[model samples]
Target chain A: MENKENILEVRNLSINFKTYAGTVQAIRDISFDLKKGETLAIVGESGSGKSVTTRSIMGLNATNADVVDGSIEFDGQDILQLDEKELSKLRGSKIAEIFQDPMTSLDPTMKIGRQVAEPLMIHQGLSKEKAMAKALEMLKLVGITNAEERINDYPYQFSGGMRQRIVIAIALVNYPEILIADEPTTALDVTIQAKILELMKELQTKINTSIIFITHDLGVVAGMADRVAVMYAGKIVEYGTVDEIFYNPKHPYTWGLLGSMPTLDTNEDVLPSIPGTPPDLLDPPAGDAFAARNKYALKIDTIEQPPFFKVSDTHYAATWLLDDRAPKVTPPADIVKRQEHFNKTKQG
Target chain B: MLDKDAPKILEVKNLKQYFNVGRKDEVRAVDDITFNVHEGETFGLVGESGSGKTTTGRAISHLYEPTGGEIIFEGKDVSKLKTKKDEKEFRSDIQTIFQDPYASLNPRMKVKDIIAEGIDINNLAKDKADRDAQVEELLETVGLNKEHANRYPHEFSGGQRQRIGIARALAVKPKFIIADEPISALDVSIQAQVVNLLKDLQKKRKLTYLFIAHDLSMVKYISDRIGVMHYGRMLEIADADELYAHPLHDYTRSLLSAVPVPDPEFERQREIVDYDASVESDGKQRKLVEIAPNHYVRAADDEIQMYKDRLNS
Candidate 1:
């Protein structure tokens, strides 16, 4: 896995939004890299800066957003320094994004065929006939049945699941090098979500596109991501391979997130939920932002921000509990069970 | 946990809710669905979008007039309540917590006024001072502070707004509450907070609930009895554990199989069982039949024997 080239590298990216109340520091010093043909999932709750970080990759941040410091390097070029004209050229042909709601993502007035073909025509300078042919093939590739007949229909004619398929088709039509899907299946039903996830996996193998999948669902992340970055309070608190993040998480916030969800076999009477809400971004915390809700918080956690401590070659977490002087604390019961299972698998 | 001998709190028999009746564009949002909620138990109704779970909840709350069938509450038929006093009594006994907190709550109203709407309408409090006291108490009951009552709904977060919604529902001191996708709009971490709060409140108030949601795992955790609905029809109903362990209907099996487990190993091997609705359109009349002691599935006579055999094997 380490031999694969890094297609995208983000280093110490910080973003702040100018609002009427005050400047909201949304993304704080987050860094990670996407390996070629690998999927890196950004998992976080609302306002955790997962979406903002991915949006920065596409240069899609809002007008009021200020990129304070850092660099987004795509193929050795800093994307943050690119002009709008250059960014637009790089958007569809090089990097494309799929938003959460398919209902509002596609243009309501446009036909499905034109919407999917327009990108190809604009990016590749293909003729109308050539682009339409390519769009029909892309539609079929996304598992849209009867693509020839359905391409002429409007957005409303398709179902929620079908509209998402079209959205994926539009994103993959140009064979972009990097695909950023932000909560792609969050708006669909579980059954439909299953189909979409399968479609995404299939498409990734065929196109060999590096993906940046951002979602709040741990279940989806487990299935889709090769590496997982757990974000909290506008910061990447922990990051590692998918197995390390799920089986042997180091951060307390990651433990809370993993334990809060009830699996199919969970028989616990009460969920181990995080006690309080996230801190106010307007008045950002001076120390570790998660210290207020973390049950095993050391005194230093509330006074000073902890640096990232390496657990393995690929796993690292920012928590005072990882410090040598801090006392050891047991994670929740469910996470302990998971660790046991992980160890058993590794041994046998 | 559910007691076997518990009395029925709400019973629906062949309840139907249809839109555009006798027209070309007619749609059956909820067909002839029959189920009974046991006293002091949470009954979870789950399905995908457009499955009519929300419609069933709205019908039980009297938000929509049923096109056909009966809804008997506490041995009294809900349709028979004609007088204003009777309707008022019925309304106070049953309350609802809507899915979207941002839309469900009034943005202009203060938290106190929103929570005290039921108390004021029912004349539960004596005066302004008493009303204020009751509002503050309700706030505390839902884990909010007295100072929060003076703020508007926009000032609160999604989870806090949901708590306010629950507080408003409990303000009426209702016997049964219908929560329609209450946690769907909330974030993942906040969802657990709201679910635990709901469970705690149920224990404290001895409340019965009709919990409706699409997330099957959470539904199984919070509900004692579970019902599966699809395309405006009730496909299966059983104990939460039994339903997850051994789903009798094909649609139920497909729905269960689609739920993603958190374990990566399990997710990697998970296979989604696709349900074919054409099997039901074979011109065979079907009804809910008891396959096990208390488990029920909507199937024809020929399919029952097959389900029974599958259960034994």
Candidate 2:
């Protein structure tokens, strides 16, 4: 794992969207790296800029989106500085994105087989016969049964899960180095979602493609991620390995998120939901974006943003609670008990 | 605990909802299924997409008339209601909260008017001023203030809009509410808020609920009893805890195993049960067999014995 090469490096990335109202600071200064064959999950609620940060890697941000600062280095080249022509050359061949809704992401008029083949033809410049054969092969790879017959069918012909499989087949047809799945399974059911996540992980072993799985579901994150980036109001509030973030979280936002989710073992009537809404990105927050909702926020948190305090070699949390001068604070009892339960089970 | 002797508020006996019936391309959206929601208890119907949980909810709410079987509401067979007034009375007794908050409410109407629509239709309030007051009270009851009455649905956030949906549902003072994936469209933080709100309202009003959702954990938290559905058929039904602890049917087991737990270590070590109903059922006609007190599973005679043996084990 240590020897694996860094495929993508995002350093101090900030972005804004110019709307009629004003410029909305969508992605605050956030930094993270993706290893060659690892899955890095970005977890956050809606409008927390999790999607914006990941979409920036593929240069698929909205037309009004502005990259105000920092760089996204894919392989060795900085993607932000690249022109549309250069970005287009790298887009589907080197980096591909699978969006949430398969119905909307896929074309209604186009056949499923042809849609999957287009990327191969455009990226690798394969002939029609070659591309179609490869498209059928990719469809089979995604566990689409009767690929021979179903490949000719349109997107509407497939069910929700089957359509998502087609979308994945299209994204992975060219063997892209990085696969950006933005809530790919959110539209599917729990069983289908498990299958899709399993499929993605299985494909990673075969294709060795680095994945950026963006979703708000912590349960999904626990299952799929090698490393996790917990986003809050356009900024990464916590970043660590999956175990580190779940077992030894430092950020208040992460604690709230972990506590809010009702587990199978939950006996309580009401979950402790994170109070208040996320900060408005239109004006953006002055100090720490999460300070308003954070229960253990310090005075400095409301006035000045805290730096990323290193917890270990792989873990970092952007909160004043991690500061040496700040008073000691602990996560909720349920979270601590869950960690303990896991630890005990691991030991036994 | 739910009252073991409590009367069933709503009883669905072998309910079937089929689309394009008597045609070559007939689709059985909901197959023969039976369940009962006791008075003052929440009945959670859970399944994957295309499993017809929503269809069942709609059928029970009379949004879509069932193709077969009887929906008996409080000792009366509702599908057999002859007069329009009888049907209207039945409707006012049972209301529904849709999945998508954004699409459920009218964009052109003000929040007050939307909430008052139910009141005006049922003539629940005497005058316009009384209706407005009732609307405001409903809004405040759902955590929104009276000031939010005049604003349009577009002016509110997703969570606020969902609250308005709840308020609208409550406006009719219905005895039962079918919340079909009500919190699924909301964000994680707001989901809890909505679920808690629903729970509080249920306790306060002693309202019976048919809570339908795909999210197993949330359903478990809110429901006293749960029924697992697959491909428009009931797989298992039991106390939420019992169902979670000892899932009887293969489909139920698979559904439970598929739900991702938040513990990284547990999730990594977890075993996912993959059950394809078509393959497992072996094309046998299923019958609901009660293996334990108030616990039911759909299985053939041989499978029923197997389940009973497994329960003892």
Q: Which candidate number has the best TM-score?
A: 1
B235-263 in candidate 1: lDDT tens per residue? 99999999999998989999888887888
Kindly report which residue pairs in candidate 2 clash with one another.
none
How many clashes in each structure? 0, 0
What is the per-residue lDDT of model 1 for residues A1-348, given as tens digits with 9 covering 90 to 100?
Answer: 777999999999999999999999999998899999999999989999998898888899999999999999997799999999999999988999999999899999999999999999999999999999999999999988999999999999999999999999999999999999999999999999999999999999999999999998899999999999999888999999999999999999999999999998878778889999999999878779999998888889888989999999999999989999989888888889999999999999
Worst lDDT 10-window in candidate 1 chain A? A263-272
lDDT per residue (tens digit) for residues A1-348 in model 2: 656889999999999999998999998898999999999999999999988887789888889999999999987899999999999998888999999999999999999999999998998999999999999999999999999998889888888999999999999998999999999999998888999999999998999999999998889999999999999989998999998899888888888888888998887867888887888899877779888888888899989988999999999999989888999876788877766875776699
| Model 2 C-alpha lDDT per residue in residues B1-313, reported as the tens digit of each score | 4787889999999999999999999998889999998999999999987889989988887877788999999898987889988888888889899899999999999999999898888889988889888998999999999999999999888999999999999998899999999999999988988988999999899999999999999999989999988888888899999999888888889888999888887888878898866664477777789999989998887788899987887
Clashing pairs in 1: none
* Prediction 2 TM-score vs. true: 0.97
Which parts of model 2 are misplaced by more than 4 Å?
A: A342-348, B82-85, B279-283
Best by DockQ: 1
Q: Model 2, residue A279: displacement in angstroms?
A: 1.5
TM-score of chain A of 1: 0.99
Top of the candidates by lDDT:
1
Chain B TM-score, one value per candidate, order as shown: 0.99, 0.97
